[model samples]
Each structure stands twice: as structure tokens, then as C-alpha cells.
Target: MSISFKKLIEPDSDLASVISQWENDPSIIPLTRPNQNQEELDHREEVTVEELMKRMEHHQIYLIYLDDQLVGEMNYMVDPSHLYKKETGTAWIGITIGEPVGRGKGVGYKAIQFLENEIKKQGLNRIELGVFEFNQTAHKLYSKMGYKEIGRIDQFTYWQGKMWTDIRMEKYFGSANNN
Candidate 1:
């Protein structure tokens, strides 16, 4: 399954629907955040298409496609308050595979690899991400992709009658590309 990305520009109905579904998907949300019930998720603040467009002005957001079919989305930004203070070209990234068919198919790995190359070309030296402790799948994937655990936030989230930490992982440009 070949993976590719296109910069997210204007929001369309299809994309909006996909985002809404992903936001409300219990299975998907737990992978990124504390496991919350549908009611709580429904009441959370929603990002309108206009808000997303505004965010695009300052971030690199892309739509992930597999064989020309939209499968997910990924985004990154240089954090002004990053520990490296942007001097080392430190950037944080997030990704979501909205389509169930795209999960566990190496689509995310390919997409991240592609985006890493793009970031390298742009002179970024480090890429980082935060994964919930319960997200073992993502932890394994990131480790396989050469990201090392740099830190963690204690009790970052509460869910399922327990507290979960957030694992911070990072990979530097020119490091071993294990994938």
C-alpha cells in the first residue's frame, strides 16, 4: 500500500465528515487521548472548518492518502517554546489514521517516513511526538521507526478508572533510519 500526502487547504464535505467521525470514534480517540465515553467526546469543543483553516496558516497539515484514497491526516509545527528553542530546528508532529482499513497496514509508518524526509529537506533536525502510555501499538511503531523515548508526563490522563502517562519520543535527522 503506497502512502502519500497532500497539503490540507480548503475543507470539503468529505474531509469534514471524516474528521467528525474520527473525533467521535471511541476506538480511535483512546489511542490519542484518555478513553472517554461518547457523551463526553460529543460535548468537547469542536473545531470548525474555518478554525482548521486558520491553524493551517501556521502549521504544516497534510491529508494522508493510500493509493489515491484518503486514509488519514498528519501535521507538524515548530514549537517556539520547545526545549531546544527552535535553534536546533525542533518540531512536534501528530498523525491520525481515520480509516480503519488503513490501520495496522504500515500506512502510518510510510506516511511518517515520507513526512520525515520532507522535514529533513526543510532543514528540521529533530521531530518529536507524544503518545499515550496505553498506546502500545504506536509506541512500538515509533520505536521501530527510530524514535527514542526522551521523557514522560506523569498522570497525564485519567481514563478507565486509572491514570495514564504520556510518553514523549523523538528522532533526530541523520540518525539510523531503522525502517
Candidate 2:
């Protein structure tokens, strides 16, 4: 299936509802959730159209579509702390395949490829992301996509009745001359 990304501009009610539903989905939450606490889970407020619109002003959020169906969302931002101030060619990304049907397929891999191309157009040379140590599936997928594990934060999050580590991964896009 061909996957494409649509930049989320103005808020749409249907899109907002889908995001809200994904936030509350048990199957989907664990993959992206930072903690296992019920309070943290309940803290996600229903996404409102207005809120989404406001977020659009500050973030690059995109809806992932397979054919004509919405299946997931991804977003990225320039390093907020200016960690790569001298480099100025790095961005952090986050992705979620909210629909179960989209999992185990190549949807996320393709979507990320598309996002990387888009980021390159803006002169970015690298992309970075974090994945929980327990999310082996995502770790494998990212590795297949050429992301290299840069570091790990041991026992950074509490989930599944234990502490879990967060693994950091990064991919670099070499310029034509370097390649």
C-alpha cells in the first residue's frame, strides 16, 4: 500500500476525534505512553479542533494516509534546547500508527521515509527519535530504516510494573558530495 502524508493545517473535527480516540486506545497507548500510571493515561484530554489549530501554529504535524484512509499521525520539531545549534540541521520526530491495521505492515516505514525527504528539503541533515526499550518492534523497524542507537537512559520510565529504559536513535542524511 502506498503511504502518504498530509500536513495538518486547520483542525478538522473528524481528525480531532481520531486523535482523541487513539489517545485513549489501550492497544495503541502502551507503544507511545511514557508511563503505566492510570492517572497519566487519564490525563489526556479529548482533542478539540481549536486546540489542534493552535498546535499547528507551532508544530509540524501530519496525518498519515494509506490510499484514502487516515491511519496515523507524525510530528517533528527543531531541537528546542538548541543542542545542535552549530549543526543547525537536526530535528526530533515522533510517530504513531494509531490504527491496528496499519501495524506490522510497511506503512510506518514508508511514512517515515517520506518525512525524512520532506525534512531534507528544509536543509535538515539528521533526524532523531526516542523509543522505549520494551518497544522491540519499533526498535527493529527503525534499525531497518538505518537509524543507529546513539544512547540509552536506563530505567527512565515506569511501565508494566517495572522501570523501562529509553533508547535514542538517530539517522543522518549525507550530502551528495559525502555520499
Candidate 3:
């Protein structure tokens, strides 16, 4: 299976809708974003396509494709100098294999590898991400990808019935490139 990433077009309602759906997906929401508070729950703002289009302004979004099938989405904050100059930079990133077709098939693993290589070539020296304490699978994936835990928040997010911690992890390019 050939995996690829295509840059998402700006203000793409169709694609944005798909991404919105993923963000709200039961399987993905807890893993990617579990910090919503009780008050926010009552007034929870949905990730509408319009809101996603607005976010696309500052965040670089990419659609992860497994051959011809769209399986997930990944994103990172845009760094203007990271791509144009050889300046060292650190970028936090997110990935979600929202589609069932991509889960349990190593798509997230491969997607991270591809994005890391792409950013390394663009002058980024470090990458960081936060994994919820309850998500052991993601913690393991990040660990196996050479991301070392740097810190943690004791009571980071309230999900399910209680609060869970968030572990911060980072990987420097020197070792990451060799992964």
C-alpha cells in the first residue's frame, strides 16, 4: 500500500467538512482533544467547516491518503522561516487516522515518518506533541518514534468521567531522521 499526503486547499468546504467530522468522531475526539470542560460541554462549539476554514489560515493541514483513499488528516502550525531559511525551529503537530480503513494498519506510524522527513528537509530541528495519559497506544507510538517525554500535566483534561494527564514529548531531528 502506497501512502501519500496531499496539501489541503484553503477554504475547502468539502474537505473541511470531512476534517470536522473526524474531529467530532467518538473514536478520535478523546485521543486528540480531551480537554473540554463541563461548562464548555454545555456550550460546546462544534468544528464547523467555516471554523475549520478560519483555522486553515494559520495551521497547515494535510490530507493523508492511503493510495486513492482519504483516510485521515494531519496538521501543524505554519512557520514562515522554517521552509525558506535554514533556521532551527520546533513545531508541534497533530495526526488523526479518523477512518476505520486506516486504523490498525500502521497508517499513523507511516504518516508520522513521512511528515517528519518532510519537515526535517525543510529545516525544522525539533517536533513536539502532547499525548493524553489515558491513550497508551499513542504514547507507545510516540515513544517508538523516538519522542522522549519531557514533562507532564497532572490534571490536564477531563474525559469520560474524570481528569487525565497530558504528557509532553519531543524528538530532535538528529535522531528522528534516523528513525
Provide the overall lDDT of each model, using Cα atoms, as 2-decimal numbers.
Answer: 0.77, 0.80, 0.76
Alpha-carbon runs more than 4 Å astray in model 1: 34-45, 80-88, 175-179
Please, what is the TM-score per model?
A: 0.85, 0.88, 0.83
Off by over 4 Å in 2: 36-38, 82-87, 175-179
| lDDT tens readout by residue for model 2, 15-57 | 8999989987877776776774656644666888997888777
* Candidate 3 Cα errors over 4 Å, as ranges: 36-49, 78-88, 175-179
Model 1 pairs in collision? none
- lDDT order, best first, reads 2, 1, 3
Return the lDDT, model 2, position 75: 84
Put the candidates in TM-score order, highest first.
Answer: 2, 1, 3
lDDT of 3: 0.76
Q: What total of clashing residue pairs does each candidate reach?
A: 0, 0, 0
| Cα lDDT of model 3 by residue, 1-179, tens digit | 87888877764667767776777676677777756565432333456677877778877778898877999988876444423222347777889998898887888998898778777877778787889999998899999989888778777777777788889887877754433
Residue pairs with backbone atoms closer than 3 Å in model 2 (clashes)? none
Instruction: Provide the lDDT at 81 for model 1.
Output: 62
Best by TM-score: 2
Model 3 lDDT, residue 54, Cα: 79
In candidate 2, where is summed lDDT lowest over 10 consecutive residues?
80-89
lDDT of 1 at 94: 80
Query: How many backbone overlaps does candidate 1 show?
Result: 0
